[model samples]
Target chain A: MRNQHQNGTNHQVRHYQALSPAQINRFGLVELGSSGPLYRFCVRLFGILALLGIVGFMMRVASSGFSDRAAWGYYVATVVFIFVTFQAAPTVAFAIRAAKGHWRRPVSRIAELFAVVGVLNLILLLPVLFLIPPITGGRKTFWFELHWLLPFSAPGFFLFFGMLALVVCGLCLLYLSALPDFAAARDAKGGIYTGLARGWVGSQRQWKMLKSGLNLLGAFYLMTFVLVTTLFAWDVSETLVPGWKDAIYPAFHSITGLQGAIASTILALGIARKFGGLKNHLHMEQFWGLSKPLLATSLLWFYMGWSTFLTYWYGRTLAEQHVLQLLMFGPYFTVFVMSFLLKFLIPLLFLIWNRVRMSIMGPVLIALSILTGDIFEMVRLYVGPFTITEVGHEMTHVPAAHLPDFADILIIAGAISGAIFIYLVSSKIIPRISLWDMKEGMLLTRVQSFHRAEVLVIGKPE
Target chain B: MVDKSILGLFKDPDSTADAVDSLRKAGFGNHTFDILSGVPYPEGTFGEHGPGHKLFVFPLIGAICGFSVALLLTLGTQVSFPMVQGGKPLIAIPPMMVIMYEGTMLGAILFTVLGVLFESRLPRPGVGLYDTRITEGFIGLLVSCPEEKIGAAEQALRGAGAEDIKTESASGGGR
Candidate 1:
């Protein structure tokens, strides 16, 4: 409703009420402390579900044990689902901030807050490290049978440490970005904020270091994210399915992560605006701004998926056919159809329309669709390979799809709920809206009259 | 003579910028004063000299060190154990490249964090001559001058419409 169309130009006038620095600080700090009944209920609900997820994890361990790799298919899918969705969320902040997109100011903190979910994912990943067969088992691995002096499993070692690096980098990124806000809180509340602030004085040197640090860390986070995704895709999924040797799989998996990151950010933005008392900060522009990328990634998701599918479709080798059957046409055919439709077909059809892409609810609904599709997609990619017991260069047989039991269902729900729980708790600690960024945006933006209509003028300071 | 740290708080950014100009006109050098705000105002918004940092150097150094270390580890392991698999050389370049890449990134990331902390002078033992109001939309122009020049610094700050001024003795330190 705040968006106004200008004559001849397609630029819609974005209505922004400039909050003063004092006002920005006050609102941000107050929001950090204020939990409405709905907020409290959601927190408690997610908390219980998160505990249930732990119980579900234990139930899974007790029943299947670490040795039964096939039984843990759903659990592996759940972990990768969290990785590709929630753990990938901070990259949204990193990307937008690196691009210097002014519209990303309010959304950056929301995306970065998802870094807290990495702690949950890291813990979830521990069991999965054990789930993966060691590289010494004569399986195809990146390690290439070089397991001479290594005491532990090579893939597990690299995967665990790679994930550890990513998680630590994500947390550091979150903390450094929030340091100034912590200082603001220290000034206002002065209890825990004092310690968190770490005596930030906002000197010119500190600000400079902060900016440079954010850029450097953002770049490192992205590189690390891609590498870790590649490792996970190759070691965990691709190697398990014999003759499924597509070099593009890791790249495709990373693309899926990028898409999931955008979807998760958009969905969280919608929820924050609708329920988290941030309606004033989040608006149509944020949704519309993100929708373009959502559309691009959707098309990209199809592009990558189709490229890989076309290879198997034409190769027609017995191994390729079995690989396809295992993943696409065999036991998981329905799941594949659903994932393909939701992830690609529906998004491409819906997002192609400008009306749908520009509206707030349209993109939010599409993001939800993509997120749901991601779960099925993860299941298709991960669970199917996990069901395969073969360890050679060719697949002799396509195994039947493994269906999820009660514990598997609980694990899926609990992992998602646990991620949300961590994000909610983190929001209370770090201001959901980036206070300093908002204030800086206020300094750099203003509305000026242009030819009988007011247009927003933004200052790009080097 | 012991120096004094004087903090001039201004409600308006224009006044803060004016205070910078006034401090210069009052014979205070650029290094004697620095601007502090909750917002990261662009460099030179207050007409102050932009400070140079060695942050970029840190990552380069880290990368070199990391690459060197990774090179030694990968090359050393392959040379010591000299095993040929699938007709590939003992030191397989592709797998070594992956580990080396991770190593380089790890080094760059670790050093970048350390560089930021070191350059920012964070976790400072004490926050001297600070006002909470600076975080509440106020601008602080902190000036370090000899004890005798504190009066003139106060004059310059007040002349530029500083809302409040605080002064404390210091044993000659630069922020």
Candidate 2:
């Protein structure tokens, strides 16, 4: 034990060796540049595969476009995905850290940005819809063929741009507002994407550009975040039979999208931490902060589910009743049940416990389960819309027809992959950890005597 | 003339900072003297010199501008669009609050990072003399005394428990 000289009080003076700034090691961020060739090949391979897959999918959609044979699968799958996105896996937690105090760093910032980026899918839907009119030979496709979707065909000032602008604006704003972050990245070295971020000076003039870009984008998020849900809801309903109406559609769509966004971000982070090899810097603390949002988003979604279901239970009308009955007892029933139990119940019961959340593997498993459950929910909702097959003596309605073909899965995969690839690839080029914050931590930091000055940590409020 | 210059033995930082506070009562020249500590010891702890520059002020100003810009973007620009949404007002204050909050915080944090970086022209590297041991938790004393009394100053530092007293030739002073 070291000797301590004492004052009149019970305290003793202890000599401490101080750190010199000259001692600070200039640590270079580990470049993920090595993985570039492999990642690029994967991306290019996906593009070729997507192109080849598109042909078969186009032929199927073209064949199925006008046939009276009902196509309920899209609605069913989307519903399930939506349910999980909102209800089950709203955010993913990182492993091996205190889940409570994770929000103080950069992880949550990215998760929030992921939620914002999720709007891209909404914008992508428009071109798909616009293409639908031409693809179906000017006749009513699944959406227009149905009576429920006729409202979309009705006159409204913003039938097209209203939907498009919201998402376009939101994405533009989010991406643009990230200019400072881009400048941060630009300052860093290595990787394929680093040079692209080069001209971003964090100068006042450049900030003016950011301000303008964000203003345009912020206005977009305000309108599009809500309306994107409306568009998706309308599109889904239009695919169903003549009169399937569910007021809970938008709520379902919004929450599910949110859930998927969170799950996507979490799973992506998990994978990126491994593949991108950012484990040392990204840390468990960040993962835990991200998980809090995941937990919260799911809770909000469960409530939304009850709201959607309670209405169906109360509405005793024939069409609504039949749709509800079909969902509860018909082919969609099993998936519906599975989604309910797995997405809401399992995560709710398990995640709320502190011990489960602290474990790294637990959250990844939960996110995966929620993802499967989401797909189940999507199948339940979309497949039912197609289950409008007239009850017949000879034919049994084959439910597999409603399932997503390999093409749908691939394109959707590609769409999501492209967005995430941008993030993963960009990180290598720039420093992921805030250098300024680190320096600030060093410069402005004050360490006080704690427990006899044994712990030299940043000063905290007593 | 035979003499012993009682200096230059071990490279030890004179951390007798506790004694510096008592110098006023001991009748030393009260002309604003500063104590340079090895670690970032607080000002009151050893009567050390505060940070050389008031760099934190720029970040605060930047934060205010950020807050103002966010509000201007939300409330100011919404006026330009003026397209009513779901019967919501043209200048929706509630939504503006979210933008303002995020923007203000972002501005504050970013400005803080930039302020620190600018204040210390770090990462723009050109090496000079430094004791690596100082970085490895060794305290270092950096001080200035009257040019004429440097000999007396050297003696005073040795008497005050300084080790390995040596002068560093100041060169390439660019930050």
Candidate 3:
């Protein structure tokens, strides 16, 4: 292991030894750990909080007779938590693979690790299931009462199964992508690693198969993720409130999720660098690569969101106007502004500068802003729709007045804590970095002096 | 017949690649020697013909299966139940597209993984020629030679700057 030697006055300046593929494997042999007391305390704290949140959620369900408003806060939190935490994570890995981005090797596994949260998201959907009333009450959902297709018609059924399929696909992708790492682990410590790394020989045939498998699976997972997000936007949010139809809303939601995924990935990489003892692996180039997408998605969010707002504002359609009022100018007005400022304005202003985009702290801070904005955005999108009482397929009045109760706070807090808990636990099980991918990268990448500073040159075959 | 396999460790990719070319020119067949290194160098790096890999078939087959499954679910449900939703058509093309897309992708991904596993034969025992040091940085060239030619193979490897060489006579493993 290369240790940082403090030379002269600058403590932050640390030198890294150029490691060959074999040397990289030696580092990979050690288990992934941040190994900080503070990290453990925070994880345990979050775990306890998550437990409390789950208990509180169940208690709230028992007390409040399964009404939409009764569970509205929980619903909003669920959407935000899932999207911000892991639902969009697969996109990070997928996008990198699709682009053949060389810098992705260090952080792709970090993004893939978020897929485990899909399981947690599925369990969290239970509250959603209970809160949804039967479609017979004139509730306008995607489901229809056709006796022959009854099993497939329910919103709950589609959502549950869709999530399940997503989770299973994620697991398969994670397993296939990390087979070589498992083989490495097995060779180092032969117990369960033997089963996990089964038949991985790293032969020419195996390499080809592995590449094809990862590519196809990655492409598939990306599609499923987008579809599932669209499903959520259409069936759950848009259709729930009568006359709340916005074609771009679903696409907007997806872009927001991708933005959040990128942000969360940056945060994870920072943690891994600072505490997890992977300074050599995580570099400025990785941050530089991700910042571009983050900026692009953030800009798209503004464009799409403005387009939706403008269409309604100019059309003067009462139904669309009402939704706009409810989300933009009504009780959640402040939140909408905060969402725009944090997610769009702040990120755009700061990230526009090349220096800020390249720096480690710049993007991380911007990501934090985007995440905060996402929570507010979720509140504006879902809470308004849930509270609206539709009669005769028309809203009696937009239920704009909003106040979060104690159970509401508990459920939302719990969901967030639960997401954190799952991610923390998952970090221990899987290698935080994809050792195989990193090795391939180290093999291909060479450093050459450009101008005054050293530049890493990545080679691709002709 | 007893067969002797010699494993040579080289300090850098260039020397290891040179030794591979030298051995191949000396009439060692493609299957006679194998190169192992921590990094994945391209197949042609050592002047060897790349192995043919037909892995795309996996995803292609998966795509077909996924499309079929989507058709079954979307069209099947529509045909079976035939309920008029909000006066809309029973077979909604728009909504079904979403389901179809997901299914197609699911099929392609899962089958691609299956293809990889089938081709790679993963979870199988590690090869005896493999050395943990290969992953650290050393490039290893393992070659099986006849008893009479073992001396020539070692000299060729040594001339190519092999840092360390080990030979073992094992009874019945070829290719």
Candidate 4:
């Protein structure tokens, strides 16, 4: 009825209200200083838990230096940190943008903010560096010992530079994507926003540049992410364990990282919707849209995991048998089941239900389940390889089951809590939603009547 | 004599489209005016979309650069200090290929983004000819006319269904 003003040519004068910058500024971001009692409580709780975990990590490091048990605990914590924070969180942004999915707008910023966590990972990697045994005789690592020609390719230098580049690239991409919003914010609040909004005049040229920058940076980040994860898997997991050789394991590890990233993105979205006051901006549509990818990744997780198992299963050699015992049937058997079932089986079953896939709660729950499974999966992957104290071409004995000690528990708690704390802090600096992208979506979308139902039509740029 | 700039707001896209047509008929060239709206109506909805097919070339150039870098990293490093393993050749193709492919893609993507920014001249700080209402579902048509044709421009816009009109000096102050 509001659009009933027909022109002489019979075109309807649609009365759509565009949100002003003021309106957008009000709802586009959650106030960094303001919070509900629940949010305050959660932050405080996570903070205390994170401190305890950090204290526990210090104790573990002080008490057990290069000892097998200490190494196991460190490896456990490292895997958890990589999966939860660094690898998965930033990935959702790149994956969605590269695919050209319009629904990516809301959650992309949330994903990009995890770029800072890469710094935390670089710091956490220090202990792992100290523990890498001297590469002598039969221990062939992916890295060549050309310490003179390629000094940076050394494990420590390589990870540091790689992670540094990743963080820088991520920040650049984030800045470029949000340049318009920064300009909008700048016009309103001319302090820090002015500096950040440099060169954004909204000229036709700038818009083209922003679009191109996002696409290119996003592609570069995705490829780099896979390569980085592969390097981590190869150096830390495969090379450290004697007589362990699996070509597909590194690739499998990277795929799992992607699944974890999708899960982390979903979880973050659910939380923001509930508490960060993003309910209107983040809709069920985003959840449903993202669920399809989650499902595909879940299937891929199983396929990769099975491929590793099948290779070992079919070979049935003594060395291959030892790998099975260490990773699957030996001390890690329970964890293997959890990773296989929770990560793969249950997720596969629950996601198969259309009702579950369509709702926000269903995917969030599935994401949590998968995250839990990821923890177990990391433990299985790391603990097995770490407990092997001997280095030989032929593994005469499979490592026995090694349970997590108190240190492992503390470190794990600390790592996870630390991830939450970092995410919360980053949310303050980077808006939870890509405000400019949201505005773009608002401009492009219109409700049209379709026989019996009103369908939303999104205009695509030519 | 200074030129005059006139901006008119239309309540609907049809009226705005009509005004664009009228302004063109009045001898205001396509490049002399701009249409701003909250929605990106299809290109040519107003007239021709802004220039360039140069964006497509960025990825090709990037891929070539990336491939070159990968070749140098993989081959150059091995040649300088050969770390032969398991009787494999000094130049391993499979592992090198992966690095090369990733590098190529990275180059293509980065360059593509740069090309867009270069073409757009983005991050340009300062305002231009714009209206806040343009983002609020109002289609605004901005035009530059000679001092003598100011009346004719006003008449054309009003006849084409402009809801509101404003005229400003064709100086930097208009933005």
Model 2 over residues A274-382: C-alpha lDDT tens digits? 6655454454544555556667767887887787668867876555556565565555677788988767787788778776666555666677766767777666655
Query: Using TM-score as the measure, what is the rank order of every candidate, best first?
Result: 1, 3, 4, 2
Index of the highest-lDDT prediction: 1
Worst 10 residues of 3 chain B by lDDT: B166-175
Q: Rank the candidates by lDDT, best first.
A: 1, 3, 4, 2
B-chain TM-score of model 3:
0.78
Runs of candidate 2 with Cα error greater than 4 angstroms are: A1-30, A33-49, A65-104, A112-127, A130-163, A170-174, A181-223, A238-246, A386-401, A404-449, A452-462, B1-175
TM-score per candidate: 0.95, 0.54, 0.88, 0.83
What local lDDT score does residue B1 receive in model 3, on the 0 to 100 scale? 56
Q: First chain TM-score in every candidate?
A: 0.96, 0.67, 0.91, 0.90
- RMSD for each model, in Å, please? 2.7, 12.5, 4.0, 5.3
Q: What tens-digit string does per-residue lDDT give for candidate 4 at B93-161?
A: 866775676667667766776676667654455445555455444667777768788787788889999
Deviating ranges (above 4 Å) for candidate 3: A1-16, A65-72, A130-153, A391-393, A449-455, B1-11, B26-34, B125-129, B140-175
Kindly list the per-residue Cα lDDT of model 3 for residues A356-399, writing each as its tens digit.
Answer: 99888888888888878888888877777777657335554677
Off by over 4 Å in 4: A1-25, A29-34, A40-57, A65-81, A84-86, A94-105, A126-135, A149-165, A402-407, B1-23, B26-42, B56-63, B98-113, B128-175
**lDDT, model 3, position B61:** 89
lDDT scores in order: 0.86, 0.45, 0.73, 0.69
Score candidate 3 by lDDT: 0.73
| DockQ for every prediction shown | 0.69, 0.04, 0.44, 0.28
RMSD of 3: 4.0
